[model samples]
Target: MFLSKLALAVMVWTLAACSETSGWNNVIDSHEPKQGESTPSKDNSDTTLASEPVSVGGAFLVCAADDSFEMEAFGCRLEDVTGEKLNSTDIKDGDLVVSNGTQAYSAVAIEGSESFWHWYIAAPLADVSLYTVQYVGQIADILNVETEVQIQHPEKQVSEVTMESPYDDRHLMFVTSIAYQAGQVQNGFNSLASADALCNQHALANGLPTSFKVILSTSTVAAAERIRILYPVYNLEGNLISNPNQFWTNRHLAAVVADKMPSSSEEEEDVTLFEVWTGTSNSGLVKGTETCADWTDNTANEKGNFGMASDARKWVDDGGSRTCESRLRLYCLSQ
Candidate 1:
């Protein structure tokens, strides 16, 4: 049932052209030549089909380090990684490449005397251990042997890799966006299965991984026990919430932010109501019979347990029942 709903969601999103506008494109366009204008001539032959295969050399790690959240482009200084200087003659844009041991990527732009090679992953990968540049013929035939290059900074662990979305986080513990209400969606919402689909939809829309689940609890199940916890929860600002010795509770939430008060300029209206529907308690355990009728009936007069974004004490329970009819957000995490 979940698979069917997910497939339908994917079809709808694809038809809607859900691709997001990324900053990476700006970097790509910076070096692209104008129409009808020829690029600088080099000794390297055009990537055209020839009677014989071409031998492309100087294959070395280009993006040796993990990407940062602020990174608009994924690349490395060629000389810094390979210890060999190169020019456009060594490699050119539009080359087909592989990374992470067989994942395909494309060379989008090159710059700085071949100092850097900007790459675009058609399907963004979590981490790329190595990159292989391929030499092709005019008919797009492989012409020569491939050269593999390892990341220069192999010590850089996956956790250090920053991403544009939580779904892209290496640990896969990152949570994406929250739903605005607790209701059965026509395409599957409110229920745990629908919640997962919504998380995946957000990830797909942002060009990130879709393996996500909701941090929710039913009357009989606990959110913490069901979902695998890899790291402390992080807010949209990338700040850590759940940390060592600290759990996801009203007390912890208030303690973490007590020292760092929100700016006065921060408008309450601008903030998406953090009143997220979590049938679990401050200790990550399911509490009362407040799961919005087991997350199926949004109109049920009974309320569901929820957490407040601004009020730490209210994160788990507000000492009051919130009607199931009220529209609220959901907390989702990737497994």
Candidate 2:
């Protein structure tokens, strides 16, 4: 399901036309001159390619580390003029290349057909940095492509910020715009599944994608494990809430943006201090079984972990618990 969703998300890439002349100050024309045309000359630092340039898209930061966190791979997707994805057989080894200002890395493995192509970097940047990806491979014939990508560490701080919308891609993490009324969280509707349903329902109603899952946990599952890949986590206002690394370490760049619920009456005004049900700790793990009996019990005797929706430092766990009957919101992230 994860891989399939990722493949589907590939369709959302901003067309390479977006790369035409935006922020790409250092231009390198890879297309060769025609028979009667003179070859265009460029600086010695320009990236070399196998043939003329073609269009490629779907560039974003990926948190692809192995168990030991020793391996890092940059990813991209190839698309034709019609916007159809290109298969792995279309490109050979050493065809696709990624270069930071200093070094270059080549494509190591291509996943499923029409899926993300992975380029392995021998020594990745110690910190998050922007990289220029240049591709020279064969489709119908020899072709080249180019785009920029950011490789982020799930536990490191981001030193650079891009002008693109943080929500440019499908990945996001935001608080619910509407808080549950105390009566709405009773027994049958208080489970993890129910919380996820509420999130998706609200997302769809707000015209947002319906791929959200609550950032919650039970005794057996950790909330941090819910999201497999960590793209930039953005809020509803199109701002980055935190870098992938800081999110796990409890170091956030800013408070998360909450979705705004439609106003039906003056009593529905936004609260200054919204509390979100988390049942998880700042570390992304369960908070000592403080999950209201795994989100089943809603009696006053059952206490569940909750976070301050406006506090970046205490967004996950506020070091306090609330009665299961209390009205609260949920933190949700794109699957």
Candidate 3:
């Protein structure tokens, strides 16, 4: 039903060593430092326990007592749990196994007689403090246990269970690196279609996700209406990149400026100015009579409105305009 800390540690070590020789080993070995270069420290390695946490995309197995019943029905990927690619015949009673070429968890077993079989999936625990082996059995319907089996470490007693989002391979999210245009394009560059293409191209070159759009405004459509509302924008490290609540407010210049500006410099005496092409007002409405001749002409002598990136009151519409020939960065968002 559950594993002891010592047993989990042994399993991890055996599995890690086994992984070094399996096909997956090529993936891990390729990341190793080259000759004359120093290897980075394993910051996440367990200091007290022998077994480390399951890798982000690693696989494991679930087993039970019924001999005739398909072990696959119990929901363990044989290859992922054991590097040998063996079938259920290789598994024995009282074993909690991982597909990552590790030793079976010898301590885990069904509570009752041999005929009364019980099994649990060996999933990675999101919160290590609450449980050493907390299994989520929903990956396969056959492995759905009535209650989760939580094995606590002997050294650390869990006072309360703090539930966190469970790690899932399919649910990963990534933020793109900040990018800029190499040069300015015409205001009517494909009527924002070209601008969006530029954003996607930069993202692709940087090995980032290509699902991005330019944060710009046209005479008929506001920037706020074009992108996602209340989106939780983040930097690479998962830090909030923009104000969540104020991003969607219409024609609210102060709110727009506050949302885009850095929080640390909000009260500074001299704030940084982040001017960008907006052609819009604080209310997200078109501001000037001239918008690069409705964004079609880059040579228009008339000026188009722009906003300050750092000025809270001026971020949406500082009542300023820049010539159509001027070049500036466009804010991009993941769609």
Most accurate candidate by TM-score: 2
Q: Please, what's the RMSD in Å of model 3? A: 25.8
Model 3 per-residue lDDT tens digits across residues 193-291: 777776666556656566667666676665545654323345434443333322322212232221222222223323234565666654344554635
The 10-residue segment of model 1 with minimum total lDDT is 255-264
lDDT digits (tens) for residues 1-335 of candidate 2: 99988876775555554665554644534455554454434553544334543333431223222323246554445533222345435455675566667776665655456343334444464422345556555443222235434333332222333323324543677787666632245422566678888778767877777778888888777676564334556777777676543464344556877766464444434656768888876546677868877877767988889888788778888899999777677887876
Q: List where candidate 2 sits over 4 angstroms from the true fold.
A: 1-170, 181-188, 263-268
Candidates 1 and 3 compared by TM-score, better number? 1
Clashes of 1: 5
Over 273-327, each residue of candidate 1 has an lDDT whose tens digit, in order, gives 5566778765465657788877877775778877765665566555565788776
Cα lDDT listed for each candidate = 0.50, 0.59, 0.41
Clashes of 3: 11
Every model: Cα RMSD to truth:
28.7, 22.9, 25.8
What is the number of backbone collisions in each predicted candidate, taken in the order shown? Answer: 5, 3, 11
For all predicted structures, in order, the TM-scores are 0.41, 0.49, 0.36
Of the candidates shown, which would achieve the greatest lDDT relative to the real structure?
2
Off by over 4 Å in 1: 1-179, 253-272
Ranking by lDDT: 2, 1, 3
